[model samples]
Target: MSSSGTGGSDYDVVISGASLAGSAAAILLARQGARVALLERRSDPEAYKVLCTHSLTACASPVLAELGLIPALEKAGAVRNEGRWYTRWGWIEPWAGPAGAELPYGYNIRRSTLDPLIRARAAQTPGVDLLLGHRVTGLVREAGRAHGVRAQTAEGEREIRARLVVGADGKDSEVAKLAALPVRRHDNGRFGYLAHFRNLPLRDGISHAWFLEPDMAYAFPNDDGVTVVAVLPDKKRLPAFKEDLEGSFSAFLRALPEAPDIDSAERITKITGTVDYPLLSRKPTAPGLALIGDAALTADPLWGVGCGWALQSASWLARAVGPAATGQGDLDASLTAYARTHRRRLRGHQYLAVDYAASRPFNPVERLVFSAAARDASVARHMHLFASRLIGPSRFLSPAALAKAAVVNLKHRRAAAR
Candidate 1:
């Protein structure tokens, strides 16, 4: 890796936390001929985030294809996943394959394999200097604008200066804290637990989820014949889960309406869980600094949108500020543009995500729409697009669509009565 002395403004961009978002931004910026310093806290190249669902939604396929990583991921045994959502009414399964002519199916892969793949790609990109074992201690601010970072490494402290500093760090980001950006948080009332299991029957590349009001569970078929099973129960049920983790998880799955036979499957990993997952939304940009991925916005884990949003946000920032990093545009204007774009594209989605994080039963509108989707193929297609992140809340819950759903339900009720 190229070495820049402490406090030297040598690189165009310095990105902290080189996992998915940081690595992606580094690769894109470097490819655009901007010198980049990608700093990772962990020295081990194989290190991965252990507490993730690792499901990449269909919305990310285009971004992955553009980055030239999809083919490699598929070769490494990533599984394509079609979604099947089970509501209280019935199951809503969209047609498998491309949703339209362009979008490919979603994917499920273990993070143990995914993190290394992205990190290696970033390290190999031209003009990118990968600095492993470097943890950012603080931001370097001059005249109220961030220009670099003070990081600690095995060899002691060093300052890496750049024209732009990006915080692609996770939820508890030191960069965001040091920058003192405004933040908004929504309470999450659900706790999540997950484990990898072998010997579980595959659903032909389909992922399944049961939305049993105030509780939810999912099974995702991942690489190498392993399925990831997760349960998100209300906090009120925490005592039972804490008493017997494995038993409680199994019973929870078995108790679902059309339960999967997980009791016959052998778990390959120890169960892991988290209870303090509040939804966070941070301002995306400051003077010479920007935030992406979970550092900028983190919603509920139950939606499984984190991984895809990380890549998407990285792509957005790279596109928005690539020319500015290369000295062709106004940096401040570019940063403001990125912030506006991020908010415009994601605010609606975040609202719904945080609302669901409360683990409340479906509202009247949700019940009407979901039930109609289950009984009608046309409604199911529209609903699938929204659930897969291809469409926003406004488009999904449009007046025309809601009216059609109501009509479909009325017809279904008449048919049932006969």
Candidate 2:
């Protein structure tokens, strides 16, 4: 990164993939007075990621609010969701916090709706140039640091120069690949199938998750009276899905306890699935560049963490590098700060998520805690906090929390003797 004034740059920051993370980062950085170029490979502003659950967790609520997106999202018919989970033991209901405090709720909207809305916001924000049909071809590097990107546009090719480059692209990131960032790969043992339904009567404004040992399923009620039903069954179940995609998917959901009535609901979208989803974590930063969203880390999609983390990571990147990108501070130090923040906030969560993606049964600790949470509202509140990404495992597994869980389980066991 340049160590002095930002006079020689076409822009202060050039962000690749003007989707959730890129647009959020561009809006945030430009708000802080940095000139930003937001590039998207797709020409249509309406293009969206189809292979997503689009369930933003509670942790991302504040960032959306900060971006002034709450009203727009609501106006666009996005659903607000508090979460409920069913385990082998029982249901862990969404708990109201102490003293009648409401739990944080997240948005449940399809990427088809969210992607274009967020991108439009970025385009409307001052200081951000939203470039569509701009596919990143190569990184502009000097002295072992990325300075910008070479992009293929509607016209001829162009070289976009900036003081700092940002990769907010998805898992198969061209920027991360071009930067030669080290990546660790972890394969998922289970596969997923997803579709939308109309008139599927899920609980109003609630997202339901069933952790049926090695398998998982969800019913997310989304915008415009539509509901999303998905299943992530172990590989052994793949044969059934392969035989009949719609039948197998409906069967999986219908078999769950308190399952929605799929028979009565209208299937709104064709069944879409992937058998080989994997976890990928890339080194998030180099000398003059930083990566955000799935480019930084891709966790198992079953957990529904991608959209939430995209907004959070974009916020963190903007906060860390805003001054430096505007030529008011050292870019290297800013990049380091962004990297540290990314790892600190997400590494622990990713470790646990990757372990679960193996399609293994829950370990002893998880069994104890989850069972206890189903029986006790206090325990459930803490569990929701942790699962929603508002709190990390350290706090969720704190000595006091575990001790309380043990007591709750003991009391349940004693009562069962009657």
Candidate 3:
């Protein structure tokens, strides 16, 4: 979009970080007539985040649809992941629902493709000015309220003013840091390892998750016949992976039930991920500032919620602040609404994810429901709603859901005795 109406470098919204959340916030805000300045540290337009879960969940499907990415994703051969879960009890595979009903399928495309595509969309948007290689150096604030940012650019440093400033800069957020936003950090007790495979077929483009108590493994289909295999074993199992990452990773996958033939598949990407990815959270908003994506809430990768949360949170921020951003409403009230929405939808999910990140085994309730889900279709479906982040713990533990699990377990016991 031309800068005719949008005040040159200044805008209604100045969003730091140009990854998933930043690009999404820029796009959504711009769509609502809010002028946006999307700043990125990297000059190369194609730069993408290297370490990522790369699996968007059903919770993000609506936001993706709103972003008009479904068509582009499909055209890029993004895999529609509708999959099964594995527990010690057995597999929890939910049955397909009514014909023609909208399926809760999530995309599993690599960041290499998804990142640039979305960033380009943001750049081409009507009111967003995406600044490449603009490293945010500081926040312009008065009396504890953010107003704009000073950024280091190619020619020199520049100050970009805005009504709303967003920190979407991932786990290590410079905007949050410059603002001195206190973060609540939790220790994640396991290391994550992920790599992509070429020519590895995942039938029906279905993803697979094995919840092996404290350890986890996944084989998720991505675009172009590529499958991403990941393992998040307890730190106790680190020595083996450290010594031989490929061997250890492959051995773990090969041992799974109905395991993929990674032996025959060509390894495309190097095995990479972080061992020190601690869970992080902060107040998502202040006077004129807001944090989106990992900057707002960094959860354990074991849950595969990163991509979905990034997309969903960006949508939330945009909706919460769009009107105010364009001077039609109050900005602080918008921030408060976004904060409430963030806490309501994600607090419970993050609590569970961070708790599990400590390398703990399943509690009694988890074990009971997982075993029942393995045996009963209805139980499995209920579990899927929870595991996929489609429903929170409260709904997952509702009397109706627990009744199904209880009944399934009782029947299984009787059948075993017989």
Cα TM-score per model: 0.95, 0.97, 0.95
Q: Write the per-residue lDDT of candidate 1 for residues 53-167, one digit (tens) a residue.
A: 7898888788888789998899988988777889878888666335464324678999998999999999999999999999999888787888799999999999998989999
Model 3 lDDT per residue over 1-418, tens place: 2211233337899999998999999999999998999999999999998777678888888998899988999999898777888888877886544455444568888899999999999999999998999999988876677879999999999999888899999998998888888899999988888998998866555888888878888888888888888988899889877898878888988888778888889999999977788999888988888999999999898878899999889999999888888887877888899999999999988888788888988988888888998898767777667767898988998888887788889999999999
Ranking by lDDT: 2, 1, 3
Lowest-lDDT window of 10 residues in candidate 1?
1-10
Candidate 2, residue 259: Cα displacement in angstroms equals 1.3
**TM-score, ranked from best to worst:** 2, 1, 3
lDDT (C-alpha) at residue 342 in model 3: 96
Shift in Å, residue 231, candidate 2: 0.3
Off by over 4 Å in 2: 1-6, 96-99
Poorly placed runs, candidate 1 (over 4 Å): 1-8, 96-104
* Residue 341 lDDT in candidate 2: 91
lDDT of each: 0.87, 0.91, 0.86
**Where does candidate 1 clash, by residue pair?**
none
